[model samples]
Target: MKNKIKLCILLLFSLSISAQKSNKPSTFERYLQTKELVNVQLIDSSIRADLKYATTDNFAKTILYDTLFNIYAHPVAAEKLAKAQKYLKELNPELSLLVYDAVRPLSVQKKMYKVVQNTKYAAYVANPSRTGLHNYGMAIDLTICDNKGQPLDMGTSFDFFGRAAGINKEAELVAEGILTKQQVKNRNLLRKVMTRAGFLTIRGEWWHFNAVSLSEAKRLYKIIE
Candidate 1:
């Protein structure tokens, strides 16, 4: 019947239009959608995320990312993070990893660098031109939280740009009574779990960890725009 054929054609055309609209993501949506990145929450919901850059609580005192954009990490890094979470549970079932920042865009990195450029904190933030592991989605800033979801004291808070936050200064601080023995113990525990899961820490930051060397990350991965 001609009427039946016309109805079927109209339905097909409508479905095709819907498909085209769905395929064309907005600029912001495309920015958040990357094949190389994985939503950490989707992989392991138990690992908590605060996402500092999404809020104005960061050192810059400005919101860097859209809050709707979920925390993301390179697939390799996400797997390692999942392993780290499992390791943390094995160490103490009540403890969990809390992510502060992960998979930062280069645009955000430049903003962070500008804020600390001329200050004493310049060394704490990496130069965007050099493109650090975080720019490549291979780094994470995180800390451990206890059963009650309270972050463990690491002698210094996240994004603390001082010698006290340096991993190498833990012993010195503990000796000077600036850092408690328990704080050092907590930092060590975090380091242990992350290292065992194939993440490496930098001497200058206790909260920062790289899933791969900076060179390796730059060579193998595309920097998230």
Candidate 2:
């Protein structure tokens, strides 16, 4: 009962913030506090973020998240992300894991699906009815970046909707000159740290890593609404 009251207060505060100045803290930041989510930086500061959905730079060509600036995740996922960051530092002290997206609300997922539902990219964006790993705060999309914060060339850019983005055909893509050997190496480096940290890589998206299986996620965590 007390928690419910606190949640209502936070929601009101978030709504108030949303109506205020653009430079002020956002509603999503306040809303995140209403949940059991953790800010990834609190677990590990070295992991950098370039949350695509927060900006208009995503495939949707729109700002999916109105004012979501920081990356947040379930505590379980956050710990593994921190472990990945530790492994990344050990592998290449000059490089760090740069996050592209993290825990997303189901409301945002619906908006994202609306943008791609009629296109070939629909499969890539999970239907909100079925829910997605990000909705469960168990999936991450990221890449490796240098000390200067320049992302390594992974052949296709982040959120590229094509065969080149698929992890299953690296050798074939390379042989066909669609992806270079160096690009594959850069991708492998990212996979190395994430896999070592217990994240599972899906075949269709090289940049995506799951903290656990969908079934396990359903059993353990509630989707963020």
Candidate 3:
């Protein structure tokens, strides 16, 4: 009877140790371990980050992210960004990529949709139901900055939600004098570097780019929440 009682105590102690180990934090238990998302800053500190969604300065006019800092992306996407940063440095040592948004959670997407839904701008913000590339950590909203960390004017500001912000409208805007040739050149420079690094730009937003297709993102990764 005493042996059986001692065995029961040992079993309980083993289970307790197992639980403690499971709860213990390890060096590998980092944001990168999330499988689909990797903290870009962890991989490359040179990349500038603004993260407008983390502040009320965005089109939503509200803070969307739970944390006030840190940008995350799919490992594949982050690798391409690192390459793009390297290319940018080669082209102009003073220039660096500044990120505005990355790896938006589905909860934040719902917040964005709530504000733009039923409006003409609704098309710019993807519906939460279908889940966009950003929800899967595969999209980025970014721009280029100089050594002083000042963003180069890309014709229209990020999240302008107008025809002026469209990549397709650059020529028309330049011809109309609304956007100078220099501004278009700056935008194209950003595109050149990003495309060289395997990112695809969207038609309506100059600041937006996808590391992978929507179909591929949906098929290959789970949405971040």
Q: Choose the strongest candidate by lDDT.
A: 2
Candidate 3 residue-wise lDDT at 124: 73
Off by over 4 Å in 3: 1-35, 116-123
Q: What is candidate 1's lDDT per residue for 1-225, written digit by digit as tens?
A: 999999999998776557434544434435656556777777887998888887788887877775334568899899999999999999899999999988888888898888877777787777888788887789999999988889998989998877888888788888888889999999999999999999999998999999999888777778887
Candidate 2 residues 78-152, lDDT tens each? 999999999889877999999999999999988988998778877778778998789988899999999999999
Clashing pairs in 3: none
Compared with the true structure, all predictions reach lDDT values of: 0.84, 0.88, 0.84
Q: Which stretches of candidate 2 lie over 4 Å from their true place?
A: 1-25, 117-120
Top candidate, metric TM-score: 2
Residue by residue across 1-225, what tens digits does model 3's lDDT show? Answer: 999999999998786556434543223224435655777877988999988987788877777763435667899999999999999999999999999998877877898899877777777777889888988889999999998889998888999977788888788898888889988999999999999999999998999999999888777778877
Candidate 1: clashing pairs of residues: none
Each model's Cα RMSD: 9.8, 7.8, 11.0
Per-model TM-score, in order, reads: 0.83, 0.86, 0.82
- Between the candidate structures 2 and 3, which one is better when assessed by TM-score? 2
